[model samples]
Target: MFTCLCLISKNVFKRRNKRTEFEILERYKIVLEEGFENGLIWEFYHLRGDKGQEVCRIYTQLGNVDWHRQNQWPEIYNFFIKNMLQLEENFLMVKEVVKEELRG
Candidate 1:
């Protein structure tokens, strides 16, 4: 029984890791589609499945800045606003808690 429990836990962890990798790839594609080019950074945290974060830095050929207050990429900006928590400037961090209950 103990061995069986260990196997089950291992399988669960493996599945979770696979899911995390897939999610990161899918979202990175979305970022590319939104015109993110050089300086794109992808980070994945080992938090709960429902908790995550995203940060974007704007550049106009000069390079990354401390902050950018304009919605230069409205589509991307709106997407972030709808999906993550918007902080000052163009930085966005995913909310730790989901606002709406997901349906099965």
Candidate 2:
């Protein structure tokens, strides 16, 4: 009985991880769909699924920013920071919901 419970717990944990990962990617899809208002663009590569892509990365680029001018740096930096905080908040929200469902 103890061994059965252990196996069941393991399976539940695995399922939770996969579901949470899927939810996070769904949020990323929304981000990509919405694009950036500050002339920035988002890109994500899932390397294992990309074949010879070498590495996976999710990042923002300068896009239309005039990086040649130093003043533009501050605004872009702030934009990046704000988005990161939002992402963190989204993740926590997803995590809690996932946890509640799995717990039930």
Candidate 3:
């Protein structure tokens, strides 16, 4: 199992006289400097698309589709949520990269 962690942010934009749109923002990916068997790699990006509809797109190289839909994803989701919450708590001055050091 390749434990790759990716950060996905979905943004919905609404403006008068314009159709609503959604954007998936991916920031960066986190990976170990040296390969580690149990290590995780996370990637973040910014996505833009039509709003009010589910946006399903492939995240190439992130994981297998079956794996995301069937196994291990819930736990992965929880991990991402937890990390996000922690990051939000310090949104003012903390850099996302600091999470690596804090994990140590």
Number of backbone collisions per candidate: 0, 0, 14
TM-score of each: 0.22, 0.41, 0.26
- Residues 1-104, candidate 1: write the lDDT tens digits: 00000000123243555444434334434333244333333333233233332222222232232224355455444445532321211222221111121110
lDDT for 101 in candidate 2 is 61
Candidate 2 collision pairs:
none
Model 2 regions lying over 4 Å from their true place: 1-20, 23-62, 66-68, 99-104
lDDT of 3: 0.34
Q: Considering every candidate listed, which one attains the maximal TM-score?
A: 2
lDDT of each: 0.30, 0.42, 0.34
Query: lDDT order of candidates, best first?
Result: 2, 3, 1
Per-residue alpha-carbon lDDT of candidate 3 for residues 2-80, written as tens digits (9 for 90 to 100): 3222232332122321111111111221222122233333322234443543222212232443454657678656555
| TM-score leaderboard ranking | 2, 3, 1
Better of 1 and 3 by lDDT: 3
TM-score of model 3 vs. true structure: 0.26
